[model samples]
Target: MASVSRVASRILVPFLVVLGALLWLVLGAVAWAMQPPTTEQLATYLDDASLAARAAEARSYGNHLMRPELLERARFKAENLSRQNQGLAPLDPEVYTPPAAWRGMPTTGTVKVLAVCIAFADKAPVTPVETIRSKLYGAGTGSGFPYESLSAYYERASYGKLHIEGEVLGWYTTSNARSAVTETTAGREELIEEALDHYDALGHDFSQYDNNGDGRIDYILVYWTGEHGAWASFWWGYQTSFWATSYSVDGKRLGDYSWQWELYSWPSGSYTPLVAIHETGHALGLPDYYDYDGNTGPDGGVGGLDMMDANKGDHNAFSKFVLDWLTPAVLSRGRRAVSLAPSGEQPEALILFPQADGQPFGEYFLVQNRWRVQNDTPLPTDGLTVWHVDAQTDGWDYLFDNSYAGHKLLRLMEADGLEEIEAGGGADAGDYYRAGSRFGPDTAPASSGYDGAASGVRIDDISLDTVATTIGFRAEAGPGGLPTAALGLLLDE
Candidate 1:
């Protein structure tokens, strides 16, 4: 009896200790869940070492917002030349059009890019060549190391209509030091010339990069070894027309090129491709949607909602139309019901014109169905997004100077009647038009032009489903300003 009692005690003691520890762990987990850390408190625990490194990198670049004004001018000239070549009249200097041919990269079919990995004599590249390649052209989710490759992002954004194929070459050492190369614009230009010269000497053909056979390389991405300069500096990631107009290799001229840092280590050490995607939008001839002068207040533009804005999500519907990736169904002067599929999944949208013969290049409204899927996962909500665009207003002047009476060239028509987006707030769940929403002249922000002219366009009875959103449009004007009753009969047909 005594021996059996000793054995039972040994096993019971160990079991009880284990059970107590399990219970304690569960209680602790529950307590943590009940009082999670606030965002500010949670931020305190983040590794500041990485933040300091990024800051140091920015300091190295001398903190300049290298606005590409010269590049914009050059692209503007090239676009006018393209129009002339196509036997179309050149637009007025104030007018802007979607770029094509020499104006920007082609938006269709397979477009090849030439990526050069450059390193200064003193600063060696931290990211490997293969890693950079994966980030540019990897196949699957993990293939790009931290996120999807640049190619995958574009392929999905374009609905597979546009494909990016390219080769990444070299850890080519430059003859100059990092300080020398980053000293001036001319220094950076020399580095590019040197890098291309080395590749040309190696018998690599450059003619294939010009997808449109336009005697210029469609686009070139240069990965320099260092931390990225924040906005505009010697080391900042930017797209511009190469300054050396007289230089060429393999009988091809280098025109538009994007310069990027070799690695991105912020918040955590990882190679994210958001910056590259945003700069590439510029290379493709899309203007920045954010306020360039930092005057985003009381009438804010798209705040971190677009790739060309804060570099957050997929390109907006207006950008897609500019790229010729999607065709929007036009809504003229009549009452009609339309069903719009998810713009991210389908190449469809609605464009409402104020006039019967209103030109697309003028003032209009673009409506798209946005869903929180794919690259649009960062979107604040999923529903119908309405955009009021004034393309006649120079995007550069208004975006840079903030002199347009707080009016953005491209402004979001917030559905919640709050004008939060215009009141220095970002997109929220209420900004999207859900079921039962009505937008017309009676709404808080009437469907009117910047000049306060009634567009006479009304969107009503918005409804949503899993796959699409349906909306009704009622235009007050008919052909020759006929009565709505007369157009009602014609519209019914």
Candidate 2:
């Protein structure tokens, strides 16, 4: 009887265990099925994005952690260090401070570029690196703008602060003196790292280089020490500007500045300031003009003079479109608007509207657009187009709009000089924002479709970057009904 009782107890226990396991599984399945994914969380991993205002405050946690650098050269007090010849001198002042509007931020004062002036070299490994200073905030060098004289060009373009010269850090020749086994690439890389250390010691500020003063820096100039073959590039870098934390690592850097260069020219056309300044315009949010406005550019006449056109001589000029976009934002930091219109003959072009984008489209790059006077009343003496105005400001820039991707269709044009901005209709079958004084509230400003506007492969799809604010569409009523006009914007001081 005892054995039988024990057997029954064991059997009952196993059965209970099985039942409990089954019950738990069923309960979990039920709970999961009942709950649904939330909208915000779901959108973070979306395959399709129809409507978006671009993310605001578009910054990463990394920016706060990033650290820029400056060198403090004290006469090479060390006896042994001086023999290596580290006394070439860095860019003048050896430190960079932002303009007053920049709030006393210590920006990346020096960019370390590798100038292979083998001409200056004493021998192998001991390559005499020419530390070419990057042009200051306002140095015109693209095949020389067609000004009557270089002085006239500097006086007009540098905003009269012409003497501000850039720096070339002291040159550091490699030591072929080391066992012949050392690789040139490795040596070059080390020199670059050392140069970075000099700046790192001084502690540079990322925010100061932000010409627009947006919380996030939009542009950076990265000077490289020793790259194998590539010329100093303005576009590619550590993307350090993407995150400030990058600087926490020994080799990390943010390529925030616009102008990049080697100490000298790589090829015949490489050394000119054209590439440096042209790239700077991009850092400031200008687009390629060769492809803008439905015109296959590198256009004739003054068209080629714009940086977007890629002309050696005149290609470095900024377009009016670029000026309107950045003028108020950068200039307004210290100065007040002299007036909307420049002096003489009603000025060439006028900034009708300016708006600040919250973010997601990265501050204002995709948030605004500029319109130029293509044809003034009988055509003003200045051949004014939106691009024309930008050049007058002594800058390099262009325009672009590609919001036709990943959404529905339509946009609105917020006409300037108008008292009321009206949205013709609310969202029904064909409702879009109507005319208003620069994208006022109470109207649907612009929109796109499920698929973006088609450009070739590289540009076929619109990226989810912060540049969308200025690239959307404005839908309004036309002869057919609802019509869309591409959006253009500029910064409002």
Candidate 3:
């Protein structure tokens, strides 16, 4: 991600509050519940020219949340890790190369921290290094090294931009590592327990600390492996720290001090910086945006390319929501070290686009009619309205734009929580916007179908037919990060 000028601390506290609340809601909920398209036309719609332009966005979102491997990597980072103190004492002259990017970023009102590794021995150790160095630290030809890729990841992720307030801990394996290594595998239970203990023991006191001493850590990236077998490799602190690079023992990861990058990779196999950064982004509360559809779209269809999608499809870039959510954490954590300009401000409004021709709940909502916004002072601008050219003043009529933010901004704008408004202004029109895309001006241009206005627009939540406009409609601008502006729906009202 590139450096942004947005500074949260300087903006109004409300901006932080709103942004924080939304991010917490979205990030905390990993159980994404997106409905798949069932109708052919709708699928075709997603494939239309406009949607196609967002291929980068799709890939970015997919990479952030969908890619299992990247998510797994993030899971690794989220896990707290520490080694059992063996007979050995903490390494002296602690090799600490600061995260170059974090050098000039914001900080939370806490102490800033950076993960430091000290598992490797001094260089040119052909002199038989023991205790920590072994045959396992070298790389194999073509197979790749462990730490190289990770180093690149740190550089790319921070790229001297985002701020993180935690320090990922890493140390060499103690005797406990030998004892636990029964057979070839360490067993999932053992590993899980160890990791839990590591985190539980270390705690987050330092995790959230920034240079300024704030108590909020948004992200901490760490990766290292302990001994797993009777005859395993020694942990390389520097020079691929914990990596088994027996392949070409590149002096790079072995605490060479010669290389200039701040963070070094800990693995022996080759690593890609992009993958590492992608994984780290997840730790900060982002989700995947792309998909490789094996069941639909087309054979070998990964929809399009994006970072969230595995390399099997596409990679790179970040999504709008990803950028929005992370921005707050970065600012709150004090990544923007400079004395920022001012104080608080918040996103004017949130949006909700629920009613659509297709329904996730079978046919129940497929043909209902209702467009709702809170009934604040702005009325249609704040309150709900029909879609398209409704019987209202705004040609977008049934469509709404609260003109400005409302008091009940999100008190109830979700599909399940939308309040009903009066439709068609009739006794039966009762209270509810005409849903199902029924009110669009162009919907029933000239004649009506035998049943009524046979328009592509269809009602979503409204029950009355006389007030219902059978036009196709899609909700826009939601607090959930769905693309509203791009989708032609006004959500902020």
Best by lDDT: 1
The lowest-lDDT stretch of 10 consecutive residues in candidate 1 is 26-35
Tens-digit lDDT track of model 3 for 212-274: 222222232333343211101122111111122221111111110100111222232222232
> Per-candidate TM vs. native?
0.73, 0.32, 0.27
- Please, what are the lDDT tens digits per residue for candidate 1 over residues 315-375? 8987787676776655555567666667777787766666424332456777888877667
In model 1, what lDDT does residue 55 have?
26
| Candidate 2: tens digits of C-alpha lDDT, residues 217-272 | 33433343332222111212212223233342233333343223332222212233
Return whichever of 2 and 3 wins on TM-score: 2
lDDT of 3: 0.22
Tell me which of candidates 1 and 3 scores higher on lDDT.
1
Predicted model with the maximum TM-score: 1
Alpha-carbon error at 57 in model 2, in Å? 27
